[model samples]
Target: MSVLVYTENWDGKFKKLSFELVSYAGKLAEMLGTTVTAVSIGSVDQAELQKLGNYGAQKILHVTGPNLDKLDNQVFSSMIVQAASKEDASVVLLSNNNSGKAIAPRISVKLNAGLVSAVIKLPVSLNPFTVVKKVFSGKAFTNVVIKTDTRVLTLSQNSFELIETGNKATIENFNPEIDTGLFKTSVKDVEKVTGKILLTDAEIVVSGGRGMKSPDNWGPIEELADILGAATACSRPVSDEGWRPHGEHTGQTGKIIAPDLYIACGISGAIQHLAGISSSKYIVAINTDKDAPIFEAADYGIVGDALKVLPELIEAVKEVKSS
Candidate 1:
């Protein structure tokens, strides 16, 4: 049996999470004395598929069809199940992103595999197949043992580092049987924000909150993010107040991000917001109130007006870059 990884692609390129999944699965395969087989859906260049070998994919199954270009959760899960069965995979790994969240549960039920979502580390014990996962919105960690013949795991994004093995993967064409009825719902149009780093993949993130006062005052936060080559994010209330897009929201109810450095500007640091960012390697909090909850969780605390401090911070960053 092999360790199978589902490598999802977007805009003809493999996402950072895809490479991480392959690398992670390869390690698991080595532990199990097996190989790693990668599965890809939709159209991607063969050269791109082969690059997965560098991340430990021994072989790749590319499933391409006319209707597979658009993401239909039902259709995608069916393809994954078929691919896993074909590969005789004992462990199946997927990134716990939007797409994975949509399809992992369905695939687990279809394969009758014990499934774990947001796994942070490799299995502590393989005999019982116990894995550590984040629980209570990143507040705690729990070790779960899967007592099943087959197992499925959805890894948390940015949890693992990708290591290249300088190997090439053998690509094969896989055509799975599909029911056209699954295509009843079709995507009409898609709009994506351009020219900004995605928060999930960002190494550093600069976030703003209600203390920024208004949406109009977001200029300094954006500037700071640009200076640091970081992504921009917002607290949940900022998005709910219509000051920021929902996609940028980070809290217990929103996206969970684990960046290297997270700078919170004008944020009070509610428990829910802290839950989302608690995994950050280093947290810097800039707030007017020293008692703000965010300071309690911050590695560095700056008690000042964000509007005044942000501009100076941006200029300092610019000077450092120039020097």
Candidate 2:
């Protein structure tokens, strides 16, 4: 038996998230004294498929087929289950991103295995199958134990460090026997957001809230983000107020991101908003109220009007960069 990791690619290229998942799986497999197998679906090149080896994938399975560009839950789960069976995988690992969240449950049912999401670290113990994850809005930790023989886990983004093993993976063109009749819908074309840093993959993020006063005042936040080469995000209310797009909203009910640095400007740090960004490595808060809930969670905080403070912050960043 081995550890199998499912990797996702964007436009025939693997994202850092895919590498992180493989790296986590590799470390886990090492702890268990097993090999690591990575599965990639789509039209990823052989050279691109081999990149998983840098993170410790001993074997890479590349699957290609018609209409593979579109993601089908049944097709994805079936392929993953079939790949796991071929590898006799004792554990299955994937990213805790949108696609992973959608397919992990179905794979668990197919394998009759216990599943865990947002796993932060390698298993603490193997005997009881113990894993760690944050709970209560990242204020508390919980140890979960899976009793099933086969296990499925979704690794939280940015929670684990990446490692290169300097070993090359054996790439094999994998063809899983799946029912073609499962393809009920066909996507004729795709539209992708270009020239923008995806919040999920961004290491640094700059977020604004209603405290910015109006969408017109978002200039400083965008400038800060551009200077830092970071993604831009917004609190839920900002989106609801039509000050920002819904895609940029981040909270318990919106996208969950764990970037290296999260700068919150004019945000009150509501519990719902904190839940999504609580896993960030460092948090910086700027608000007029020193007692704002955002300050309590921030590594660095500036108590002032965001409109007044943002310009200074932008200039400071520019100076640092110029220096």
Task: Give the TM-score of each candidate.
Answer: 0.97, 0.97
Report clash pairs, candidate 2.
Answer: none
Clashes of each: 0, 0
- Positional deviation of residue 86's Cα in model 2 after best superposition, in angstroms: 0.6
Alpha-carbon error at 146 in model 2, in Å? 0.7
Off by over 4 Å in 1: none
Model 2 lDDT tens row, 193-281: 99899998899999999899999999999999999999999999999999999999988888888999999999999999998898899
After TM-score superposition, what is the CA distance of residue 303 in candidate 2 from its true location, in Å?
1.0
